[model samples]
Target: MDDETSSHIDDTDRRTLVNAQGAVQVVRTTSESVDTRLQQLLDRANQQETEMTDVADAVSELSATIEEIAASAEQVENRSQTAAARAEEGDEAARQATERMDNIHGQMSDVRTELQSLLDRIDEIESALSGITRIAEQTNMLALNASIEAARADNSDGFAVVADEIEALAAESQEYADEIDAVLSDLRSAADSTDSELDAALVEVEQSSDEVERALDKLGAVADAIEETATDVTAVSEATDEQARVSQSVMDRCTTAAERATEMTTTVDAIDQFRAEQTAMLEEIDDALTEATPALSVTDIDRIPTGLDPLDEATDGGLLLGGQSVIQHDSPVVDVVATLCASALSAGYAVSVTPPEAMSRQDLSEGLASHGSSLSDALATDRLFVLDMFDEWTSERNIFDMRASSLADVNRETATRRDKPLLIVGNIAGEIALLGEEQARQARYENDSTVFNPADTVCNVVDERTVDESFGAFYAGAADQVLELTGDGPNRELTLRSSPTGSAPPRPLPATSTPVSPRGD
Candidate 1:
């Protein structure tokens, strides 16, 4: 039992041990294989984890880039909105500019239309002015032709009136004449009557001058005879007076009586001689006056031309053609006459005036200048002559005698000098009569050729007191002309009225044509 039992037991134990060892080894091998596989799995899991971390870093970089892109897109959207707003503003401004341009164009069109209308109106005005100018020219031409025809007919009255009208027309034309041809027409009218009037006047004056020459010779003989008789009478008276003185006492008385008788006889003889001489002078003066009468005829007056209508009408188309004597009284009537005479001279009359003391020379000069004449030119023409009567008269007898003598002498002289009219003025009532009535009448009647009555042609110069009323009355009267020169407030008017009958008015005298002031060139 023992050995076999030991061996069997051992075997049994060995078998049990081997089986248990084999089972344990197999379980250990399975666990190690599982641990290696788990390690490999863990290593793979770690690699996966590393891969996951790298992926996460890459994802963060991509997210930051996406955020930057979003910001850029927002900025671009804002810029686009700003651009759209600016474009809308620019379009609105353009529309407003177009509207302003349309308004300006409309204003320009209206201005153009107004300018065209103004041009049309200017053309119409120019046409009207042209028509008026043409009418004025034609009127002037007609006046000129009429004046020329009248002058050729040798009708002085017609010539003077027509010439005056023509001159007025010419003056009117001067304001509008644009050429020399129109001025030539005026000159032709002025020249037409000069030669015809001068020739006729010259012929009449020549005939009268011859008659004056004969009268002068006869008067000279009478004067010499009167002087011789007076000398003889004086000698006889002296002889008788000497004889009376020689005889003394009673004889002296007888001698004185004889001497007185002789002196009386001598006085009577001298008076007779003076009377004869005066008669002879009167006869001579009458002859001279008679010869001068024809030269002063209206025919002579008609041949001359006067350029002024007022002057020609006042003087019956001429000046004092009939060698008439005009008397002027105090009241500036003399001044009126002087103005008339001056106007006559300007119209080509040769005038002579004897001014009284009452006439104002300064007023006369100013009056002439106012009539559109330079004082120097009026004086230099020798057309007007003035005699101061105040300077000529010495005594009362001298005044009467001088007036008579001067009238006779002037009448004779004027007959010789012709070519223009003459005016003689005298202060007839101013002188006192030295001779008796019969003697004075004889002196006046014999010496003077033309006698004028004061009532018929006397012009009273109105004083300040009754100037307005007197002037109105005078103007209404039937005189050849009325001249009213007065200072009325701030105005001065020279009114002239023509006589109802076309005859020259009575002119007192010509005034001295003295220069009032210096002349301008």
Candidate 2:
């Protein structure tokens, strides 16, 4: 072969090799971008599952509240109905009393008429007595004249005797008239007294009748009001019942959605696994390409901040990437965990392990929100992962149903899933409650060997009030860093008791370190 031909062939082979390397680089870049998008999709699916589960729970709570309202409304309706019936009865009774009073008033009027008639008869008797007296006087005068005539006629004895007898008869008639006049005056006085009494009785009866009529009117109004109230209560009860039914239906649908979301999450997991395999293949291809070219550079940070300035300063930038930390606190552990999670997530991905009942998702979300981040968004972006550990007593999927040691593996895998530094915060007291003290101690011992990865930064919180001295001491002794929280509310303090490098100093906690209440509160 000629020298020019060999040189030309070599240049052609070099150009082809250069083109292949460029294509490999472009493919690797594209694969990385695709991998990131797939990861985001998987995270969104997981977030949807969590949201669906929360919706189901909220709906159930609403249904229960609706049922309680319905029950209260029913009670109100029953009491109002009883009151309405009693009011009606009282109205009827008042009407009967009013009728009786009217009858009494009529009877009293009749009596008054009779009394007036008696008064008239007494006055007539008085006139008759006056006439009798006048007649008596005239008769006496006639007798006296007869006596005088007898005296003048001398020897008329029989006529004089007859005149005397007539005078005596007139005297007796005057005496009887005077007696009748006295009796009539007494009768008239009694009639007047009786008539006055009847007038007073009639006034009282009329007053009572008026009062009874007013009372009947008031009773009728009360009955109507009570009936309306009962009807309104019945309507409220029925509405509450309907609301309960609707809430129950909503809960059922939410449960179904949650189940479907779970299935979707499972599918996402499969996709993620497939993506991992693809990533591995891409990485292999890149490794081979690197042999023919310069390798890409990557910078790794060994520590992450704990969000608390003093804590970060004390721990020399926070927690070591591959070390375990123990936090023993007299104050609420939830706040400390929140602070740690918020800070760690600022740098990289984070995994929080806690019991389902220890701290609600809303509380955690609010904690994140306080740091100017959204929990749902973080979760959907795969920057934050929450693992709920439920005990046998809890209604959630119990972690205790599996081997206690398996939780360490699960936590480790979750912490190491991403290439980024991960912070794992757990509540030791909650774990103890799930798996008794002895089992928890054993698990803790096992966790040291299996739970941590080289890139994992783990913080375990222990409530001083919940665990014994020995248990807390053991955890402290095993951890690379030991932090203690003291005091309460705004006065709370975070102090590093032990450090792997022994450089971090104690610092005052912020006023916001006060307990983060649940979302509902």
Candidate 3:
């Protein structure tokens, strides 16, 4: 080969190696994110599956309870029907008793009338007996007079004998009259007693008839009430039956849902297995990629490593010297900025635009201290710069304020102050969180004013919670790369996207043994 051709081939090979190394880092980073998200989804699916199983059990119990209620309702209905029948029978018996009482009362009245008539006949017989007694006495008196006259006329024999016979006959007639009178008196007395008894019995029978009538009326009302109750009970039983049927249908649906949930769980398990396989494949590919281009290592390049190993790997070594990195987070990014500042301070000067409300100097210092760096020492050595994002920049004594100043001025001034590469960290999201969107917008505008000096590396941290998605997208679009942090605490994850249009899929930040706290607290 010609000398120039050989030289061109060497340059092309070197460039290809660099590109291939960058691609490996990107793939490795992307796979991590996929793995984290997949694990989260698997956990959620398992929880849902357990919850669905519990729901199925509850529905089964409800179905059983409904069946029991239906059975009880049926029993009540049968009992009510029986009660109605018994009431009806009682009512008929009461009616019959009332009729019998009425008949007995009528018979008693007839007997009473007959007894009274017999008493009246006995009285008449007594009167006739009295008359017969009086006649007998008169005849005896006449016979006595005839006997005395015969004695006075001394006419013995036949006349005197005739008078005596007449006297004896009169005496016998009087005796008979007395006996008939006594018998009549006795008959009258017996008849009076019988009439009194019959009258009493008739009264009792009448009262009994009235009592039975009342009872019959009451029984009839009870029978009607019982019948109504029976009907209501029957209706209740039917409604219970319907409810049981509906419950059965619901249970059936619940069973189907349970089956579906079980199927879903199985599907999720399958998906998890697939994800595991994909992850294994990714790891293998990453390993293969790592071996393919061992000659072109990221350490050979002059890039800044963010102390965070995961972040360094995601960025393919670290931030480019003049590139702008946007740190987007759901929470405060003070810790993120501090970590960046600490790393930047190692190589060159670090500058931060901070709002006191979001993070005071002490807070930032503490955050830096956690990473084994001293913010005060960096400031003493003139390697760190702090600016108040909300206050006006006044005199040298108040160089921290920068409300009237712009990022462009800071960028230019910082460059003149130090020949070393600068790391500029802006808190646009912090301003929005503490101040308002308007101020954040102003901050954004100020940041836009600064030119991309090759001697400086710029980073702007934004809290995703404080801004709209479109605004986040817009902010990300203006940056060279985006470092996005998600979740909180143990579940937190970080991803990096290095696409100019932000179209590239996000890759997981390089894994770290311990995560940096979002709030630096």
Candidate with the greatest lDDT versus the true structure: 2
The sequence of per-residue lDDT tens digits that candidate 2 reaches over residues 279-343 is 78867875665465432111233566677877877876777655667888877656667666766
Q: Once all C-alphas are superposed, what RMSD does model 1 give against the true structure? A: 87.9
lDDT assessment of candidate 3 = 0.64
Which segments of candidate 1 are over 4 A away from where they belong? 1-320, 323-330, 371-382, 392-407, 410-419, 430-521
- Candidate No. with top TM-score: 3
What is the full ranking by lDDT, best candidate first? 2, 3, 1
Model 3 worst lDDT window (10 residues): 1-10
Give Cα-based local distance difference scores for all models: 0.42, 0.70, 0.64
Choose 2 or 3, whichever is better by lDDT: 2
lDDT of 3 by residue, 176-245 (tens): 8888877777787777788778877887888888888888888888888888888888888888788878
Order candidates by TM-score, high to low: 3, 2, 1
Estimate the TM-score of every prediction: 0.25, 0.51, 0.56
Candidate 1 local accuracy as lDDT?
0.42
- Candidate 3 off by > 4 Å: 1-83, 153-169, 199-229, 277-357, 360-422, 428-450, 459-521
Q: Candidate 2: TM-score?
A: 0.51
Clash pairs of candidate 1? Answer: 156-302, 331-461
lDDT of 2 at 410: 61
